[model samples]
Target: MVNGVLSPKETIWGLFSATFYTNVRANLYLTGSSSCLFLKSDHDDTYLADKEGTDYRYEKWFKNYSAIEASGMRCVKILDTYELTYSTRPDARVKGINMLRLPELYYIITEYYLSLENQDEAVKYFDKVLQSRGLTGYADRQGATLTLEKVIQERRKELICEGQYFFTQKRYNQSIYEPKSGKLYPASNDIYVFPLPENETEYRY
Candidate 1:
């Protein structure tokens, strides 16, 4: 979004990056807690910052990392606790799209998934959930059919400037046990949600 444009993008994705990036600074060791953040800028292209300095933020701005790679291991462990076995649907694998930059596409799908109170959206959410897609994966198939739309946007509060706003909106709602506070933030209400802006720093040599 532009500096003065405080509105959400009407589209279904939020892909463009920002000049100002933010990072979290922890005050103490894990009691499962953290504090104030240190913000900087991509005014160039800098690595994104994290919330509380925990790796969980990785799952927010990133679609690929150890957390996702290990999600299956954790799920399997939980499944085992039930003394239950599991099976992958024949459609369990999907073609990986490692390069796509449409964030709204991801935001909408994740929204629909979290909003579903029933399994009605389960098939749509994870018919073949274990695919390594980047961006286009979420929007490649538009049809009478439905699917899981990987959950990434809302999970990325710690990922500001890493590209999260419109795509996340109110979806992928990762509750804040403690509000995410920062030094370089706008008003509280303003920070809670967002409006999409355009990428201003265009190619210049």
Candidate 2:
């Protein structure tokens, strides 16, 4: 584990390319383990400075890279994980939108077996997900036991930055983990429910 988080080189990580577009004028909030993956600064000075007086400051800033590396966060921009074939073509970019993946079906089957109190079947299905993602060792370490908590954690790791975690929490009525506060807010209607848009409400009979 990296920084108390799992950082396996799972095949699932490559299924989508999540990125931060600096050109876009919009607000984005990143929560949970995914937030821990970002570099603290964008400036080269934060990493390369070795001046006599400022060396200490640079050293402190450099430690952030250790944290990022430990978290196993992919540096997509630097690595060029997604290639841009045409300089002028707007469509030659990786789509960041979330879509249903085959792994979700495995997780759903695993949950179904768990609900039926069939641990063996649950583990069997759950292992399929881990195996596909080069995480069979994780399953082996757990042996024959499989719990909902284990399933939930695997989901969080496998689905990080995929835009499905919040809905997963809501479906399970699980507490939301707030990274800034380092606290979990209990599940409640106030937190889960969304008010109808003003336009929709005004037009309704």
Candidate 3:
């Protein structure tokens, strides 16, 4: 895909409009968070969606923890694990925030849309696999039939409100209409608010 688009040396996901990255990095910092960490992935599906596992937050999880396989109630072997090596310098919170708030050094990419979602939330969701088993979680075909689609559906409950509805609608060929204003006519872009004084221009170019 790289060679097809540009030089073979061109990095992947070094593609895409970047209007979002700066905003994302700014939001993370404002919320007082650190981007320096890693998580380790132990399951064999490591290469599946987004390369970050089901969500972008697991990038660190994949770097810090190892996987463990166990046969629980349903006779299915599940990989379970939790928080691993996270060494944030104590002063990073008080000191580093002032010295230099570096922007996200690189654009993140993953196999699934979940792989590109908010990292903090992603970690909590998948970590639930180790325990949480409501009607909408973990698979157990030990007594039932779960085709590929069924197992895939099991993960959706974890992804709500994570900027995934757009991708989901696209994947399923679902069409979303623009929200109507006070009248029946569709709202135009001009009705969109203007940018703040310090932000970039509202022009689309």
User: Which runs in model 3 stand beyond 4 Å of their true positions?
Assistant: 1-140, 175-205
Shift of residue 175 alpha carbon in model 2, Å: 2.1
- In order of TM-score, best first, we have 2, 1, 3
Across 1-205, the per-residue lDDT of candidate 2 in tens digits comes to 1111112332233233344332110112221343433432333432232111222222221222233223322322222222222234134334333255666778899999999998778878887766654454234653446778777766765555445778889998988766445666999998999877799878667
| Between candidates 1 and 3, the lDDT winner | 1
Candidate 1: regions farther than 4 A off: 1-103, 120-123, 126-130, 133-160, 166-187, 190-205
* Model 2: residues with Cα > 4 Å off, grouped in runs: 1-80, 83-96, 137-143, 180-183, 196-205
Q: Each candidate: how many clashes?
A: 15, 0, 20
Provide the overall lDDT of each model, using Cα atoms, as 2-decimal numbers. Answer: 0.29, 0.49, 0.26
What are the C-alpha RMSDs, in order, of all predicted structures?
A: 17.3, 12.2, 17.5
Best by lDDT: 2
TM-score of 1: 0.25
Give the alpha carbon lDDT tens digit for every residue of 47-95 in model 3.
2432212333222222221223111111010011110123342331121
User: Per-residue lDDT tens digits of candidate 1, residues 22-66?
Assistant: 111121111233443223222112223211122322333322114
lDDT of 2: 0.49
